[model samples]
Target: MKIAVASGKGGAGKTSIAASLVLAKRGVLAMDLDVEEPNLGILLGCSPGELRPVHQPVAYVEPDLCSGCGRCAQACAYGAIAWFGSGLPVVNESLCHGCGVCPLVCPTGAMREREKVIGEIRSGFVDGAPFLEGRLEVGGVSTVRLIEATIQAGESLHADDWIMDAPPGASCPVSAVLREADAAILVVEPTPFGLSDVAGVLEVVADMKKPAGIVANKTGMGDLSLDDLCRRFSVEVFARYPFTRSAAKAGARGVCPYRSEETWVWKTESLWRAIERRFS
Candidate 1:
């Protein structure tokens, strides 16, 4: 089963949940699609060398090829191609989606498709579970392309279970990662802000018609009103993690709190079993 773990905002323990699931379930391939700020490798104690670079094709304008017509620029829907008054069109490497249409529209063959190393895809073994992740270069805006690369890397493995950990927020990056997931686990805190953001995520999932569930993290410290919100939205509250200082410290040390047989860990284990039962 392909499961995606996501959150409405950052610092909601999404990666922690995803990593614990990978460790608990055997033969699982963990993919970290949070390319912007991937911390899954750090939390799992996986080394950087195990990961490799993943590249994507972007347009390269060959100035010598000819007439500075704006057909290439007009054909590009992503605004990746910009035409300077009379010069050959300049390709904005960052904005290009490498859709290959620009080259087709170039009358003079001035635009060519070339592979660019925009990001890296890394994979390592964590407690016998295969962990794969992608990282986009800083200041890079082609997160969607890198995410596609990450998905391709994980799909090539053909593991029994594919656990995808998406970046925070319900935007293009999150949508790209969650597109093909069999199930989605939306992790949220019990606070008001968490409830509001999760509602947005649920709307997106609902529109996609993807099955989903909620995991309330840091449950004991807040009002726990998220339960009402879930019920109102007809979403299941699959699990809860109580607020604990030791758990916090372990996370700060880049460790999975689920490593111990404690309250939150046991709860997370049960949550995984529930997810498997619902989607397996």
Candidate 2:
């Protein structure tokens, strides 16, 4: 059973809950799909893993073999290529999405793809569970593709119980990670702002028609009436974590509260079992 834990906004304890569940059990594969900022490994007390660059095709022009037919420029949907009715087309690397269409439309075979490392996928272990995380290049905007590639690598291992730590919000990257999820856990704080964030993610999950549950993290901090909201949507709020000083302190130091204390550890164990009972 593949489960994804996500939120509509960042800092909603999404990663904390995801890390807890993955560590609560032995050999449960944990994948961090937040390519822009993956901290699951750090929270799980592990070093950087085996790294493989996520390569993308970048268009390069072969001036000698160029016919300046402008076919390559016309085929580029991203407008990465520009031709002025003479000479080889100029390629804008920053605008390129690496679709490889320019090369396919090149009649003289003048356009070809050069592999560029835009990001990397790392594989390591957190306890006995396999850990995979994707990191995008600084200033790189190609998160969806990197998330897709990272998940594909994880799927190749054929793990039965996988927990995906997805990016926040209902954007393309989050959708990419949740596409293959068997179940989704939308973690949110008990606040009006938190509900707004949850609403955004709920829309996407609902449209996908995936079985989903809610988690009210940092409970007692606010009275957001999450129960009524869940009831209206006919979704269950399965877990709630009370705000605690220890959790705050541990999080400040890049540590998970469940890993640092036994009480939180047990709480996480029970929470995962509840999730399995309902979704598995």
Candidate 3:
């Protein structure tokens, strides 16, 4: 079963919940799909091994072969190609989606399609569970491509269970990770910001028609109640983690706080059981 843990906003303990879930359910492949800022390895206490470059098809223009025609620029719907007065069309690597339209529309055969290394996939093991993560190269714009590569890396492993720690926010990267998930675990806090962002994330999940539950983190921070929110949304409250100093310290030390009996380990364990019951 594939379970995705995501949040609409950052710093809501989404990664914490995901790491705990993987620890509770051994043999589950944990995937960190936040290519922009991957923190799962820090919590998992494992360094990424065997880094492999991930490439995506992008358009490359040969300046010498160009006729200065604006056909390539006109054909690019994404505005990836721009003609500079009389010079050949310049390709904006960041704006290009690699749709192959520019090369197809180039009249002088100046445009060619080639692969560029935008990011890389790093795989390793953490506590007997396979962990894979994607690291997008600096200034690289192909997050969705890197996300697909990360998912593909884990899919190749074929583990007993798969838990994906998706990137925050309801964008392409988040959608890519949640697209194939059997279920979703939305982690949020009790504050207004958390509640609002969680609602947005729930909307995305509802659109995807994926079974979902909520894990409310930092339970003591706000007066807001999740019961009413869950009832209104018809989503279950899967788990709750309170604000604790030890938990924070453990997290800072790159350790799973769920391993400590003083923390909300039991609650997270029950959450994992509920997920297994639902997915199994």
User: Best by lDDT, which number?
Assistant: 2
**Residue lDDT tens for model 2, 44-98:** 8877659999988788999999998999888888888999988879998867889
Clashes of 3: 0
Question: Which segments of candidate 3 are over 4 A away from where they belong?
Answer: none
lDDT of 1 by residue, 6-121 (tens): 99999888998888787777788888899999998887777756757767789998878958878888889999888876777888998887789988888878789888878888
lDDT of 3 by residue, 28-103 (tens): 8989898899888888788987899998889988888989878888888888888876787788998888888888
Query: Which sequence of candidate numbers ranks them by lDDT, best first?
Result: 2, 3, 1
The parts of candidate 1 lying over 4 Å away from their true place are: none
Q: What do the candidate models score in CA lDDT, each in turn?
A: 0.84, 0.88, 0.86
Better of 1 and 3 by TM-score: 3
Q: Where does the lowest 10-residue lDDT sum fall in candidate 3?
A: 256-265
Could you say which candidate leads in TM-score? Answer: 3
Question: Between 2 and 3, whose TM-score is larger?
Answer: 3
The true-versus-predicted C-alpha distance at residue 22 of model 1, in Å, is: 1.9
What TM-score does each of the candidates earn?
Answer: 0.90, 0.89, 0.93
lDDT of 1 at 193: 88
Model 1: residue 234 alpha-carbon error in angstroms: 2.2
